[model samples]
Target chain A: MDLVFAYLDPGSGSIIIQAVIAGIVALPILFRNRISAVVRTLRGGRAATPPPPSAPPTDDRPR
Target chain B: MSAPRPGQGLVREPGSWRDPAGFVYRRDGAIHRQIAPVFAAEWEAYLASGLHDRLVTRGAVLPFEDAPIADALDPATAWRVIRPEMLPVISWPWEWCPGQLRDAALLTLDLALEALDAGFTLRDATPYNVQLRGTRPVHLDALSFERRAPDAPWGPYRQFCRTFLAPLALMTERDPRLGLLLRSFLEGIPLDLAVRLLPRRTLLRLGLATHLHLHARAIGRNADGKGAEARAVRLSETRLRALLGNLRGTVAGLRWEPEGTEWADYADRTSYSDAATAAKERIVRGMAEAVAPTVAWDLGANTGRYSAIVAETGAHVVAWDIDPGAVERHHRALMASGRERITPLLLDLTDPSPALGWGLTERASFLERANAELILALALVHHLAIGRGVPVEMIATFLAGLAPNLVIEWLPHEDPMVRRLLAGRHDMAGGIRGNVAGWPLFREEAFRGIFADAGWEIVERAPIEGSGRVLYRMRRSGRA
Candidate 1:
């Protein structure tokens, strides 16, 4: 974070816009699992099965 | 005494780390002092005495008054109030001209003498505490003095040497312009550096030996142990007075006359006819009148020719130039004319003052403090744009950040001065491309594009005949 702020020139608005985009993309990914766990715990763990992932994961296994 | 009024918005100035005992704040455009409750009794007694009035009247210290304590109550740690006489501009020692630094040093010694006589001793002795009020020096930190240290051998001796003596010695012995070292070592020139920088001949001088040479050795030896031997050398009041007198004599003996520079003789070499000069002055006066700035900065102000015109608009003008000789000439002109509002300082815009001191909070960075109402960058952009290889957009952005209003002069490469700078430079392919090619490659459109990028709007532009110099009036989008 310190590096980001230091490197971002105050006069350049593009750096700020890039930072906002990065933040948006990373925010939900960082908290999605923890948030779901908290929601389950708060509901007394009634939903024992896990929910599906937000997006399907692609696989490329070596034969 | 009661607690301060709520919502008075008297936030402590964040830049008082050098002073640990008290802090300064601004409320309703008036400066206020807040003494730490630990030293309340001493502060009260000091104020009650006539010493405060004496110091203020003699122009040694900033004047202040006891403010009415607010009714909101917190008996413990209640802060004292003082409305100090505001300084028009606060300049650090690093930014000070050699004469100003010398004056501040003398003023500090004089204040120390007076404080001792008043049964007090100066606890802090940093050049940052002193500021130029007109040509004279005045102490800005009133809380630096405390009750007399009857036994202490000038408790602030090390600080005094670091801040004043070392820099003065280096400036006098090596080069008058070596004072710029203060900008690098903000806590005062490092004693170790000074010891190395001083000439071998300096060892012969008793003052240099006792003050700087021995002082640095003492600091190194006593880095861990108790400083008993150093403290053993005590001065009687008479001896201390003599020491101060000696310091004054030493400083008085040291002098630097800005001798030779290319543009120092610009007034003589100018091709401008008398009528042309008058016309330029008229345009400058018109711009100043239009802006009516309270604080103006004139960049590249050669001998303060246009700076004087800006000051004529009743603004406090800070004239800055890269050439010390030019600044010196401007200062002499001000002295001769008895002009109080104009202050000439030496500064190189390509490399301005940076954040310095402990945690970079002691003295304000140049850009942090350079918030002038009007900035006059006359005949300056060409040097930055062509000579030093700075982009025109970057220059515009920097200027826009400094002031709300700008009076810039665009000098075309066709001008003889520009031709002189372009001489003897490699014409590599990558080096000179696009508008960078040919002197005066940038047209008004380029200037407008850069200014617009920095959120500025051009109000007017007047081109001078046969000179290829155009004066512009621009305002920041927000306000004057």
Candidate 2:
């Protein structure tokens, strides 16, 4: 990151793609998280809370 | 405009010219961020809304303190100047190994997601906004966040793809060397280029397909202004969250194994006998402990075997290696072992990372950001001296500028590694194939005079018994 903040270009094409796929791009993740949340609830939410849509997996490591 | 102009006691950071909200400058030897009057409101809200505090607590961003109003060096341009925590070293995305880059990408996505909850948003997403301390990354750009733009498409959508997503996919699917493409495409690898290089099977991965292939096509289509409504499109916070989630999943799913790189297995497959290796390690450990430097650079640090030893002396070690695989593996090991002192980076000394971006100073050249107090050149001299055909004189001069003390090794021609390298070369003047009598690197005479001329005086010299290799802990004489 050379020293600048993105003075926020949000290129036209990228915005268009996001517009085209925003509805379905996250379906699988949404469904997976929803299912996991329900499972956690059914298990009485002992150690973990039903996470929000954007929360990282419980631990920080993605690998 | 109250912008930072040339010729002030304040030296505006080179890469800061791109950001309109604010720019960082050094005045009186302290880093101060000068916020333009236009961004004053947002800067205030960033603190009042407690976003700064929240992110600081999570180690998400570099914490800062508001300096007294009188301290503003460029009062005309400075609405407010705040002092930010100093980042000891800055390593660019090109030098980051896969794991480090992956971690940086994750941090970018995570910050964006967290910002949304506070009714604020990340106006842009780029790896440059983040800095790594060891394996941990912290956001560096404070001006990227703003109150959410309702009904607006995520402004940094392409920036994210170009800067993070594309290179990541290329690295995981194509080759880790493609990650070095960041050096060429500082804006991030072009999506179309990434799409072309990625295997066709990647189209099956939904997130990649949409963000890369479809994204590239959309950009191309809009290049002609056909999608005039791209700016008019309304993205609900819900949909935006969905987009963020998708990007996170795609990035998290991308993986690159640190195996099969040229030097990944070099440590275990040694040219020296077990006794020689052990003797070398002991010697390196003793010398590093004696110096006890705060920071050490292990040039050509293959697997960080010696870097780990240097760090044991309680120094923060920056382990740089030419091999991406070796750096990646070393970084992963450090992360797994919870060691935060050794930062493994990808660097090819023959052609090191340069000061690039705006004015070629925004991104610092490798030498520009060098933070070594002791340099470990173990088993590395021969490679740079012969493998790259760089003369010992230039090599010594370069090392002199990197640190005040040095632990370097000299391998004679009879040494198996040098012999293996020499077998392929007929010329030995000073290059890969130069005539020997002119400059035989195998002899210390090849480097001794050059080292002295470069202002390095040998403090101690120890020869590895049996391997015929010599180790010297040298003290630098002049200023680096």
Candidate 3:
């Protein structure tokens, strides 16, 4: 099927530009922890890993 | 919205008008989404793909039953009408806690990737497409997914960025209050605005630099044009998958730890004794059980102490507070405990979420959407009365309008919390000119009289020992 599928419309182009830019900007921020971990390992030191996120204190009981 | 036909018995929802694929309508107290003719092919493909079933099984997508309305409103454009399971409550992105937004962002990315695997992709990445089914995030827009082309970039990428990524980034890095910007920007925060408000240090972060700063510039360059120049850039399936993976990774890594704020650690500083707290809990529990409401709203649900107790009766509770930190902490606790009956939202009762969008009818206001059977205003009246300076009668009027059954805690002026709220007050009855006297004392009779005038019948009144606070279980007259 030689149908000319104009999938990328004007509206779509605008959306694409936003996504591409956002995706590129997000790469470093999102993977900073891993990036730092790798950098630490290359310098012959263990990565300073953060502890797992904990639940908030549920007990609102007074002392 | 289009005018309702003479006797079709259908009212099209205002918010869903933006999407060309279809519009949702309410007919005889049931929700139905109509598939338009333009999107018929896509809709057919989506049903045949089995992805809907897969998503429904995971509780990721809202499950719908195929109930085709015979006498269609406009049969010319209507393709297929299906009835969907109505969510108990509809919460917007601006009201979500940081943890909830992060989870929603991750869920969108996950669903997009999964859709790609099944030869379809989400047409848009708006957070409005997702809604909370309790603590769990559920994708509500069934028509959002369309057949994906081999090397075409994701269409909803920018929307996803604006709606989910941008808000999440700002909330995580700068201040959680930044999430409230969504209420202002109905179409999601502009990239230019986000980049400007972000900290200078964020430039060091690669994600912020490229996506926000650089993305803003790109958008600026193509502002006058229809993005025709950049339309030639074809993103392959491999790259698209990688893109989704990156989004998932970034969203997953962005965590906002709820640090102690004014009301986040309120429970620890309260003057109530252990026995008093227990007694109060028992009273609240007993009152909540008596109402046996399907939905309950807990106003000023700081750290969700009483909200959790209310949820014990198997009622879906919406824990609302002004402090983002408190809501965030409550949300995290709920998530950790695997409790899915309560939703913690940041809401200032004074200036609640307003009815916004076209003709101010699209996204209903907090009070409009929230029509709970039971309302719990525990330890909240003083905040509105003294701190915010809302008159007692006005508070009673608003509370009465919120629900039929209400459990409100009234603290006398002598109470430590109320005193602290009034300590720095110089207004003193006569507008800062007359005597500069101390805070005016709030009497129980005055409070009771106000509620009575507002058509509330007091059912049970319980007092916390040594706290000078009274809890009233009041039912609106003519409602019971």
Candidate 4:
């Protein structure tokens, strides 16, 4: 979990950016997945969108 | 790599060392993989997870069967062994056309996305992890996946960008040939270097700017080894999925339509008359039928007009051409038709893809994979002979090593097509000297003499009437 030793580089800049990026966009993605999951429950069947893992990932647009 | 492991017969593949989880070897002509003892738990988990079967069914991962540890290089170090279905030919990402590489990138992201849902994470995202199954991409490394650590950052995030997105974007915005940059930077073109070479307009695209230009700056600022400042970065599973979604959209949106290349439309333009074309087809078909090869190579296979004929004999064809646009156009059509027999590639014979990576052997050269049973070299010799002036003896010997049977066409310098190319040449021998005096005379006798010197004997000869074109069926003199 820590960048004590990254398999690729010592700088760990790559890891830091990912964390910052995730922090910036986390809330919107949480809401979207929640809404999609609710929609699947309402349809009264397995998710036609995602989380089933048999089909493709749901499309996501940039914020 | 001859560090000499414990096993007496295991010949380790050069490219298998980068990943510590497993190493692949060849035993009795079939590829065998031995998982390291350290990853035993993960290997067992993977088998029981049903994800292997799921991915295999989706045509994402190459199918494999369990094998005994007794056959491994060292049972002490081995935890599991699997024999994956053999690839007809092992080709690298550098030799692939743009369409092929894009498909590979998409496959990588798709697998990573699906793995997350299944409580697994892809460890790395290098293009080398994927190989072409005909025109399609299949993930070959079984160890790239591991059980997810809750709230952990995607470890290969930068790797995915450096190896796949940067190369694809450079080709899309600049020139398709820029994809060959991957050949030199085997670990994927460095993002900083790519940002410099890429056109400024790339920054105008939000995804490209953030993912490439901005990503490069991030890495640049941390170029100083600040191990003290390095800290654990947590990204929630939802955030990781969001990052993956952004990547998927960016990659899916980037488009490169192959167009306006010299040979992309050469198939529709002037080269041969109707009857000459038909005669050439007859010769190629008869030779293909006679050999009934399991695999064939069509050198200078522009747009695959003749490659389609060779594939009719049920042989998998590797259609090669120098023009990226032509190879791109050829592959797009194969994808559309769902024909898994013809694999089109961008290649230049004068300067072919060479053995590269650790010890210059990790990735195999183009000629190393040229183990095809038949070779169809139609309308290509002139370019090498007169246009490029490569010595005939050199060309003949190289062709001899590729395949046993050959369906080749020799063109004299007097033909209209040859004349046009000749008009562009001034002092002969590609303007290096005032001609070496018939050093490259494309005469019929010279053509026959060269291949003869290369230990090939002519089986049958047919000359297209009054076209200055001759077709021959030749075989290695003593191969039978």
Query: TM-score for every candidate vs. truth?
Result: 0.80, 0.87, 0.86, 0.89
Better of 3 and 4 by DockQ: 4
The 10-residue segment with the lowest total lDDT in model 3 chain B: B432-441
Please state every model's RMSD to the true fold in angstroms: 25.9, 6.3, 9.3, 5.5
Fraction of native contacts, model 4: 0.41
Per-residue C-alpha lDDT of model 1 across residues B193-238, encoded as one tens digit per residue: 8999999888887667656776676566556434344334444454
Docking class of 3: incorrect
Q: Identify the leading candidate in terms of TM-score.
A: 4
Cα RMSD for predicted model 2: 6.3
Best by DockQ: 2
Residue-level lDDT tens digits of model 2 in B113-185: 8888787888778998898877688898788888776766788888899999889888888888888889988
What DockQ do the predictions score, one after another? 0.00, 0.35, 0.08, 0.28
Query: How well does candidate 3 reproduce the true complex, by DockQ?
Result: 0.08
Candidate 3 stretches with Cα past 4 Å from truth are A1-63, B1-8, B426-441, B478-480
Which residue pairs show collisions in model 3?
A: A21-B211, A22-B211, A25-B207, A25-B210, A25-B211, A26-B207, A29-B207
Q: How far off is residue B197 in model 1, in Å?
A: 0.5
